[model samples]
Target: MPVIEVDGLVKRYRDVTAVDDVSLHVEQGQIYALLGLNGAGKTTLIRMLLGMITPTAGSVSVLGAAVTAGARSAWARTGYLVEAPVAYPELTVRENLELVRRLRRLPGGTDEVIERLALAPYAERRARTLSLGNLQRLALAKALIHAPDLLILDEPVNGLDPAGVVEIRTLLAGLAHQHGTTVLLSSHLLAEVARLATRIGILHHGRLLAEQHADQLDQHRRRHLHLGTRDDTAAERVLQAHGYHPHPAPGGGLQLTDEHALARPDQVATVLVQAGVPPTRLLTEEEDLEAYFLRIVGADHG
Candidate 1:
């Protein structure tokens, strides 16, 4: 069985469906990320996975055990962080981790985790006094203090600085690749997810719209030729005269998606240069994960 299995999982609130007919599987050592914007039901689906909220329909299984309201078997084997990080405001960072360790009956690993997450500096500092970034690190520390088999995080990089983001990314990657950990996370950070997740699932409007391997993502995103010249108006006309259709890009440039234009951008540049417009910048640019995500979700909404 996969490390995590979500079969036809769904949730609803009155007349509104928060999640709809979503099914997915995560195997050992694979980092699977759910990609969606806020209000896309990513949080609701995650809540169901952890059995924090009962599903309106469908089912969820973790570590080969069915998730139930009272089921605690898989609870000890999983680490998760949903939405904002919380801690006992009166407790020191070390004390908070100790609390988790004692509650979890773990032998010992607090010191290692503190260093691992670069939390050593704040280990003795009270949670209430920690900065937003440090507070987030503490939340992650508690989750990892148990060293559970599966780690589920929502917006894991929230409130983190650039260096902190890189640290967490490296930590997750090392856990998956080296320690055989199965990680399931949700994020709207498209580029970061592209760099990290082994597989990605797109959720929008309470539905799972698409799934693909990260390595194969490039082939799926749209590719276009972008042209920037001294005179965009003349550049657009010149491209059109050369049997190419040009559309205004979001960044005030011309975007051409014709097979000919993409296949031979140099030729298009030649045309633009000869036409007195003179190409300032010309390159074939493929849609990044963010663009692809917006395109897919926008198409669904439209």
Candidate 2:
């Protein structure tokens, strides 16, 4: 069995279908990111997986055990931090971690977990007194307290400063690499997920649109040349002449696909020059995971 498996998982809330027949697998020692906008059912699906809520239909199994109501033991082997974070505001950072250790019956290693998350600097500070970034670090420390085999984090870096984002990213990478923790990370930050996730699953309107290896997703949206000239009409004409369909760009540039399109950028430069257009700038734009997601899920809202 895979580390985590969702088979036709379905969850409904009142008149709305929060999760609709979704299914995916998370293997051991891999970071799988679930990418989606708000209300895309990612949270609901996560809740079902953690056994916090039961699916209206379908099933979820983690570590070969079915996820059902009151299955606290199943989740005992897992660690998690939800999007908004759940921490004891009055308790100090170290106190919160100590609580988690005792709750999990861990062998008194809160210090090691705090060190792993780099939370020693503010260990004695009240959770409510810490900044947003520091609070996030404390939350992560709590999650790692038991040294779980599986880690589930939703928006782990949300509201963090640039340095905080990098710190969290590095910490998660270390956990996955050094400790061999299988992670299920959910986020709307496609760029961050692309950097850390081994595989990605795109969710749209409570349904999964696509799943692919991070490298494959990157390759699909490879860099292409964007040609901007004095005359948009003439530039489009020239690119079309070369069997290139120019994707529309907001900042007044004709977007083309493939690195091969710009293999001889000088050729297009010459064409524009001969046509008396005088090429303004030739920029290469690499396709990122966000670009691939927008392409697959589209830019329009339902």
Best by TM-score: 1
Clashing pairs in 2: none
TM agreement with the true structure for every prediction: 0.89, 0.87
Candidate 1 lDDT at 118 equals 99
> Which residue pairs in candidate 1 have backbone atoms (N, alpha carbon, C) closer than 3 angstroms, thus clashing?
none
Where model 2 places Cα greater than 4 Å from the true spot, the runs are 222-224, 229-260, 270-280, 287-291, 300-302
Query: Per-residue CA lDDT of candidate 1, range 164-210, in tens?
Result: 99999999999999999999999988899998999999999889999
Candidate 2 Cα deviation (angstroms), residue 60: 0.6
Per-residue lDDT of 128 in model 2: 90
Q: Look at candidate 2 and tell me the lDDT of residue 67.
A: 84
TM-score of candidate 2 relative to the true fold: 0.87
Ten-residue segment with the worst summed lDDT in candidate 1? 293-302
Off by over 4 Å in 1: 228-254, 270-281, 299-302
Lowest lDDT 10-residue stretch of candidate 2: 293-302
- How many steric overlaps are in each model, in order? 0, 0
Give all candidates' CA lDDT scores: 0.91, 0.83
Alpha carbon RMSD to native, model 2:
2.8
